[model samples]
Target: MVQNIKTNLPGQGDEDRKIRERMAKIKHKILVISGKGGVGKSTFAANLAYAFVADGDSAGILDIDIHGPSQGRITGIEGLQMTINPDNSIKPIEKGGVRIVTMASLLQDSDQPVIWRGPLKMKAIKQFLGDIDWGELDWLVIDSPPGTGDEPLSAVQLLPEMDGSVIITQPQDLSLLDARKTVKFSQTIGVKVLGIVENMSGFICPHCGKRTDIFKSGGGKKAAEEMKVPFLGSIPIEPAIMESGEMGKPFVWMFPDAESSKIMKEIAGKIRAELEK
Candidate 1:
């Protein structure tokens, strides 16, 4: 869970200046968000960071899922703790091509619950943005909590210059509904909708190399077309992704040639191209 920010809240004017000062050093800030939970959002964010890293760019990840911080584990920095620098800024934990900060890493125990109200949650997220020493980075990937609620909204509000948001969903109607809601939320908030990534669109059988659309397919493509957003690409559900995540190793690195890894790499490239454009 997030640290206590209620007592140490900053003055509004000063904090805004500090936040802009900090963000000025970062080039691109992209948020990976979903309308519903359990859609592999964190995983996508992690691998995307790794993809940028693999491309020789400096990247950082701000895992803003206050209640359910999974980027710590996904980025293989689960047990790591943030330290203080000479300037008293909280140092983000470094691993792979990404430096990371997550509420889970601050917990003394893994099972601890972060029971916080809206104000407190907002304060903590602000601190993560204004207080962390992100230094000069090519990309800052924010893994936001599900829904159009406080956490995700706070990230959008805090980073006014954020590049865009990537919506994630599975190939199912229920998931597509949430995905559409997310797209609308981004549009309503006036943030750019970079594109949509259809995760878990199908399952690839390891033994036979055969593909199965267990969740039914093309829903994400259809939804994106209807919504007039660019459809980034589809990532199939492979056993390797699950296995690697459980082992605290990002699959894109562990299985560089795997089908899903290639898909994620392509998506990352597309995002870079969009940012360039």
Candidate 2:
């Protein structure tokens, strides 16, 4: 019965000084999970944070889902309500230039329904990872809530040095056995899978263009080559991505030269070339 899960850092409790200042200015903080729901994994963490800010970089999305946030309607920044600076922190919601953060922006009404549990969803994902304001960033996608509970175990216990994790699956076979239990629960907690995306996977038929496996294609790239990891591709089945997430805009920013937005910008350029190895 090992019980000691104390992690505090929402305002000034300096939890390891704000997680070592966000792993020293964030070169990476991926985390775009999945192991249950409809397996879009917050639409691949909002089109990989809009293809990592349209390739210029400096990104940050962080929805943490909180039992269904959907990155404010998939990055259109739905309702847009967060504003509390006077030193209380948390403002995150810029859009277009990235830096999002959401529980639907601390909701006033975005179809409210947090109905919290598990210590208030682990203190609102530890105040969206220590009181928001993820300033300098190359990437911070996040978007969890699809299994391995308590907001991806409070983002791996408030960033136990996170730098990788992306697992989404929808090629069926029961979503490849729940995406191999989210890749063995991120290798039993060390967290660094960085692969396995296969959302929707097939359905180009617009007037018979063929290719429609519907939900049986490749089985998340053969379950990422039998769970070794690193499949990171396939994302078909576009109906303008459900009309650009019902007009909140996000089929990779309204079909950036579609074909599922060029496979979500080549899956955000193979996750920036596997985070430069």
Q: Name the lDDT value of residue 98 in candidate 2.
A: 81
Model 2, range 1-277, lDDT digits (tens) per residue? 1123324322345664775675578788888888888677877788788877877887888887776787787777788787888877777888778888878777787776878788888777876777776768888888887787778767777776677788988997988998998888887777779899888888888897988787779898898899888997888877778778767777777667876778788888887887786
Give the lDDT of residue 231 in candidate 1. 99
Please estimate how well model 1 matches the true structure, expressed as its whole-model Cα lDDT: 0.86
Worst ten-residue run, lDDT, model 1? 1-10
List the candidate 1 regions with Cα displacement exceeding 4 Å.
1-12
In the range 208-274, model 1's lDDT, one tens digit per residue, is: 9788999988888988998999999999888778778878788987888877888888998999998
| TM-score, prediction 2 | 0.37
What's the residue-level lDDT of 1 in candidate 1?
26
Candidate 1 at residue 212, lDDT?
A: 94
What is the lDDT for 83 in model 1?
Answer: 94
Models 1 onward score TM values of 0.94, 0.37
